[model samples]
Target: MGTFASHRLKNIRTLSNQVSLNGYKEPSQSHPCEKDRISELPDDLIHHILTFLSTREAARTSAQSHWSVNKWTFLECIKLDIDWFHLDREKFCNFVDKLLLSRDNVNSPIDTFQLSSHAIDRASTWLDLAIKLNVKVLKFSEDRRWEPFYLDPNLVVFSSQYLKTLDLSNAVLDAIIFDQLNNACPALENLMLSDCLMEVQQISSSSMKNLNLIGCSFIKDLSICSPNLVSLRIKDQRMGNSSSKNSYLVFGTITLIDASNVEIMELSAIDSMFTFVEQDGSSPMFRNLRSFRLGPWCIDDNFLPLRRFLQHSPMLEMLFLKLSVTTSEPPSTDGETRQERSSTAIGWLRSEASRPLITLWPREKPLPPPPSEATIAAATA
Candidate 1:
């Protein structure tokens, strides 16, 4: 086992050497002083290269190689990708236990700790150690080939006040995660969730500055309430059975309350959350939104929801529309042909682009007083 672990670590120096090649210089007659590019790398990169090594291998390398003495002992990032080395669960667990114990002896604060593995059912102690170490950025992802890791909300309260970034992928999130978010990582500014399973209907955060959601859905119940968020990106793609299209109708509302300071936003494939108008036709506002991106349904009435978004964002300067030429949903253009309706919408968009005023475009189709759900859904569909 130790021999195989050492073999796994043999390539760390090679990888680091590759990264350092840009700085490497062949011995030249003009430049007398030979540059040791590998030694010039920042400690963070060096530590990352060393992450694959077990403690024993790291000690041997430090003793016999050109590495700095005891530098691995002070690594700020603890990234364990057990699957990458073909390490078994028991051996991986034992290695981590010893490594963390040795790290506890050093009592150094961790800047980042990422774990990618399938043996995380007993990962609480590892996470707790990260919190104790005051890790600032933590990324934990489970192997998709195994059972999903259920993230316990109770264990999330990262006692570390310095924790600023948290990324969780391929896990099952509890609804209570939102309830304990503020307390879990009070100073958290960036939160990224990708390919997770959850029924979290609403995600509310006041301190978070950037929030990214990528393909995170099980029942499509998702909303957001973040007043201090500066940048937001959501790429919603259903990750379940392809035969079930009903599960794909998981667009939730964006509780755009107290969100007058958002500067950048991207809503791909799920723009309905932000542009959705209730039966009464009331919609929220984005007073300070400066840049916006949207993914259009590309079917009939798609421009209707877009109209609402432009109307709400008074400060929008850069508008990016990802025009999809194809969509599975049928057109709902009433009697007007797709070409005619598309021409009208495109012309209106052109006219609006030329105008500086944030006013409504000219009424085309006898505009209803309050567009009903059927109407909004048709447009947003």
Candidate 2:
């Protein structure tokens, strides 16, 4: 076996040198003593080394020898960032197709598959292939230049029992896709949905441990029932253009039916009408919560809800209050002036004396001294 492996490796090195002439420059001929020691390694060891290289680098190296083609098949991770393809959509698709086709006979599982592309018409096929390969960590997104891509969530046939993490950005999702995720991906632990269009009314999962929903504008209500969830973050709007209208209305309430296991939670840009619902009346909502962050939009003129939320979290240790300047002034009303509202909010902040409070505000505005016992900080961004 040792002799056979050595001979195979030698043949691969010779082929690699010939293939390298296609695009990459060939190295100057050297004495046999100065030849690459890497080429002398066993096939398995060479494949292990190739796995550390980027997809582009691996492809370039594989072109140098016909034997190196087998090394690419042993790769467990594939990341095709199409930006490097120079926006050649057809060429990118063809390359991916050929790569997968070549590995059609290989039964090795793909540990990670991340693809960022502008051409998403064939995304379903690629996802199907990844599922067939038993992908564990899957991240799919369209290029930043285009609007959010609409994907048929049902198209994701998650036959892979090994799937643990899923991240989808700038995509459209409906109730069916959420249902499929809950039923198909039993091993899913972490899920991140960012800047996407959501048509689902409820997002429930039993196996999920961490859930992040950021800049999802279309979700009207969140009904999470992940009993294993330890961390949760929900942000209603994106940073830029706060005035931009969404296709669908923002969530009015977040129903934590079975989220008593959650330990850390963050809420940002939540409208005043939004509230929390605990299905179980016997237990307090967020009993395990230790860290809580309330974004600027989460607190409007009213501080009662914010105060009530903090009061429920008895074991809370770290508290973050992100305050932002509203671009437009509130319309004059006979009920209460802006100054009064600000004063009332400040009074509520002073009342939370038990926890360590960290106040975060924009950098453009001068940082005021710490309020009484609270710590004043600026936004890291």
Candidate 3:
């Protein structure tokens, strides 16, 4: 592997030299000092060149000759693509375990490591290695469904101290994952969790500035205390079987307490949760929120809270409601009260229909000219 990496690096250098020769605008003359100058470059400069290639490629270069051998060990970024090596699960696991144990003994500080694997055990080991290396950015993913029980969320937390960005998909996380994470990764700034099982619990953080939750199912109780969150996105898992409403289940209320500094919020669910309406005297959850998107088909009487919540966003610049409205089992209140409430809502929308729509184009664009008086009279005639 080391020899191959060295050869590839030398090839790259040759190609670069050829390009430089072709592109140089000045007349060149060979000087005896030129070779000495090239050889005088610090070892750090050669190691930087090796770091640009894959770990395998870099190692291959090390074996090209003695000069390249020690240079590969100074790599700042160790990126490994196991697929290119044609190794099975057992071989891959052993390879990573050896590399990590050997590298840690030398106290190597790996800035970045990307491992794509089908073996969960290998991934777990790599995670441990990353934590030991004090990796700055770690990306982990699997193409095969490895047993989930063998994976530990603690390892992820361990990586969080030095980790700045994390992208995890199609994995199972123990419920206590958040507890470990909150304690370990106080510096995490960007987070993406898609199709992962998270143990439902309180998720309080001031460090996360951007969050995306996509295609996740088991959200029992989600609470956010991050006041500095700038972008927030939550999307429901798509259903493919039936078009009917029988599959829908209204779960639990999702509360947001301290996320008032959000600027962009996109929320969509297959079921309705009482969306808190920010009122005149009420405390707003998202005070700086400018864009709000809600799945239209998910709204029902349960969504009245959300409508009421809208009044709180005085600075709201955009409102998108994709309603597939359905009727829910009404409360025990008399029909008269329900009718009155419905009427009031209709009247409010009617009155505000002519006003500048936050969801529409320009805030100053006049609403579609109200039905022409002549057209109304003609319909009556």
Candidate 4:
């Protein structure tokens, strides 16, 4: 023990002598404590110094640091991608548990909390904790193709009073989500759902302002009742498929039960327009509607849907028609090519000075002929 102590002293003395020979000043008594003491400084001061550190250098601090306070806690934005666990449920839960538990005392509210959909059962627990922490924007992403995680009904009952945006991908949701949001998340205004499936057919939300749906399917006929909704956009994710249908989106009925106030609406699907109707079969006046975008399906259906909208939405201002190079499944059998059919839709839109101005764009590279001079004015006549 004495020999070992002597060796350590000799090495220190040699280092000191080398510093002296190099004209370097010897470190003071506080020099040894400066490294750890810097971390004890004000958070803002320490954060500024930390900004100069490279990501690799910063990562070193995470080593053996899980138990350390003020590390992963106090985060304003928390995004947990569970793929790192490789489906190890125990580790995933443990990681999320520790991360959220550490934030129990954080004063700042979480701005966004994102979790991957692959986090199977315990997702509810993590989500509940995030909502309890006053998460403002909650999002979930798809990890497994088309696999959905249930938004626990119990969790939804007390989700968030401050949530403003709910963005979900590859999630299995139902009308319960919308029905329950009114009381628990009164502030939610924008709802974006993609690659998801609805177990039920009806969704009713009174407060949504903007709704976006992409590549979504429903088990039965679909109905939406959002009286306060302003902007509604539904896009067909499967655009170029030869089949007349989108496998990701299967619905027989699409009814806007109470969207009379919607101003800007865009529908891109195989049959969304033709199937669109009010539940009462009466034309509910979209008195505030200003802009409407339609896809190729309207022309394939002989402009029946277009006619319905033009007649019902008296205040409709601008119309947009997006045509794919090829028509989707159950090819139009009226002996009229899609190009010919579109000219009729466009010709009527062009001839009418009182009707909404129609803007046309093909999904393909080639452009079609100019609007036919032989106008099918019957559409808007």
Candidate 5:
């Protein structure tokens, strides 16, 4: 009788504690942190949250719970990073095909679609979808190992009239491909191409306002005839050079015509020769250029080209130069320092500053300005 009573008492105490703990609510679990998490969010709120994540991560969220599982397919802006070429190609192709077909009922067009290509066949398929969806921003980054290869012709011809920004980096392309792209993309405004190889015979475009070509090689001559090119950046180690000695001897020229609206131009090239000559007998001018950055290899003698460019740019204001004393051609004296090279560059700028509407820096250091005077007056005089 005593043993039976002891067992009953222990069982009742255990049951009472289990009931009390289940009834009690923790402060954190009920409030904002866990409360605002995916399950608790409304459909619209969840859609906004998922937009920031890549398509892969957004798809994985479906495993979290029932609510998340049903909604992952509704993502509008999908960014597919197809870097793993080791995977079965057929599997990847089928997966992409299904994902695109699944979104046929979407209410809004895709805003951004970024892809990294290891397989051209897969990339072309994705690009076809972007055209169908009217994707606004399309970016393609090719794998580094695959080089001196051809691009899919469909990609060059595909047009997304609403495309506002285009970035093609680390790809081996040709001028013919670019010609097709420029013709297709009429509304494109911003373009960036870095570490790209193109035997670019000509660059023809319009409606492009900002252009950045970093670490890109040009073959014989580079021409920029776009009237709307407002800002241009050309920088990276040794741009537009061919390895062949005979090829190197052939002088390559860069032509900028009717670039009057450009406000900023940044250029950096090393172990390469360049000259910016305004087109002969042309009324074209740079009316709005305010800042200029030259290559580190630029010498005092290099300023000859800018004399005409400065005459056209009446509102020029700031200058940044990368000048070095050491060159393939040695300095006249051992005492020549980097500081002296900078001084030489500044002197050339000072000569250009004499223009009625431009400012130039003569000294090596930044100077304190009068507090009451306008910066334009200080910059000009």
Candidate 6:
């Protein structure tokens, strides 16, 4: 036994000597991998990879030392959705604060920056940073639980020349902001405002091609002048009957004055009033219009406005009308309503020479049956 033990010790010593001579280290003494190939990637390439991930995920990755400590600042696109924070407002705020702080030294332009959060009041710094970065596409949305988020008008003074597209939701806007946008963002193309509180009376954009306003209220008089606009959509949300004057819902007048170049227009002002003011004595002619959608309110006042509006859209090829039927009445006994609609249709056809394709959609709690053969024949006749 003793002889065997001595022989084993001698063999081990001989093996160690051979390893030293060959300059070969044991696997246990060396790193699992020779080098971190991932970390060795170029900063720009790593930034591109981080752009595909959410802001939270990117921050976590950076914390793990997979990339440079400040590699996230090199990202061209930053999308931070508060939903990922699971209502942890403090954590979300901290993350955003740290992110902007880390990019303080970065002069790189951000291609896109989108942030959706409930606490928009704390996002002024974020917006400032975005503007400073010369962000091209910026979208800021707030939770609709409380009052509309009020944006600081002073921030609008620092107009970003690189801003091309802007989208805001559940915010308060005024004329100053619009004027600033028109002057600052020369390349602005698309603008969208949804569920916003409007304090502005006029929205004039020479460079804008697409404008969308949904559920925006509280303007005594509103006028839109976008000669280069190709698409416009205005929709109003249904509001309850309340005596409170401070309610966000208020009926207002809207005028589309210089939308002659519009190709597609969707107007839904069921609660507010609308008028198409002509440039001169002539009607506001939509020379390039191809698609038009009229909401239930279009049929108000016996569809007079709709008929008159159709006269201007001579090139219109498609028309969509949304009609609401009273569910309180029996579906099979809508004879009066059908007759009234048929007569209105006949009047419209006689007034407008263009024979555009018309589609009617009925909306209510209970779905109404399709028009009977007789009803269709009568309408066609």
lDDT of each: 0.61, 0.67, 0.56, 0.65, 0.59, 0.69
- Candidate 4 lDDT (Cα, whole model)? 0.65
How many steric clashes between backbone atoms does each model show?
0, 3, 18, 3, 0, 0
Better of 2 and 5 by lDDT: 2
Better of 1 and 4 by TM-score: 4
lDDT of 6 by residue, 144-257 (tens): 665677787765443877888999888888777877776777889999988888888777879999998877785668888878999898865544442222257766888888
Q: Which of 1 and 5 is ahead in lDDT?
A: 1
Q: Please, what is the TM-score per model?
A: 0.67, 0.79, 0.67, 0.73, 0.68, 0.77
Q: Taking the tens digit of each residue's C-alpha lDDT, what string does model 3 give over 1-381?
A: 467556655664543333221123234565564332323446766665666666665554443334533456557666665674464566556656656666777788888777777655557767777866778776666553342223575454453577777666655665566665556777777777755555565566668888877555454766666767888777555544322221213245566666677866766654535353233565666668666665532234534654655655555655554433224535324443333444444455447643213332211222232234354345334
Top model number, lDDT:
6
lDDT tens per residue, model 4, 1-381 = 356445533433333333321123455554453344333545654334333332222223333122264543555677776664566667667767766777766654677889874646777777777788888898887664435667777665545678888898777776677566654677888989876776766656676899888777767777778789988887656545433232445655677777788988877665554355554555555778877777787775787877877777887766778875555634468877777788888997778777876778775432232222233233334
Q: What order do candidates take by TM-score, descending?
A: 2, 6, 4, 5, 1, 3
Q: Candidate 4: give its CA RMSD in angstroms.
A: 11.9
Task: For residue 117, give model 5's deviation from the true position in Å.
Answer: 3.1
Local distance difference test, candidate 1: 0.61
lDDT of 1 by residue, 10-45 (tens): 544433333221233234254475444445557766
Q: After superposition, how far is residue 225 of candidate 3 from its true place, in Å?
A: 1.9
User: Which sections of candidate 1 miss by over 4 Å?
Assistant: 1-71, 154-156, 218-220, 237-251, 270-272, 275-284, 297-302, 327-329, 333-343, 353-381
Q: What range of 10 consecutive residues in model 3 has the weakest lDDT sum?
A: 360-369
Clashing pairs in 2: 15-65, 16-64, 16-65
| TM-score attained by model 2 | 0.79
Error of 4 at 156 (Å): 5.1
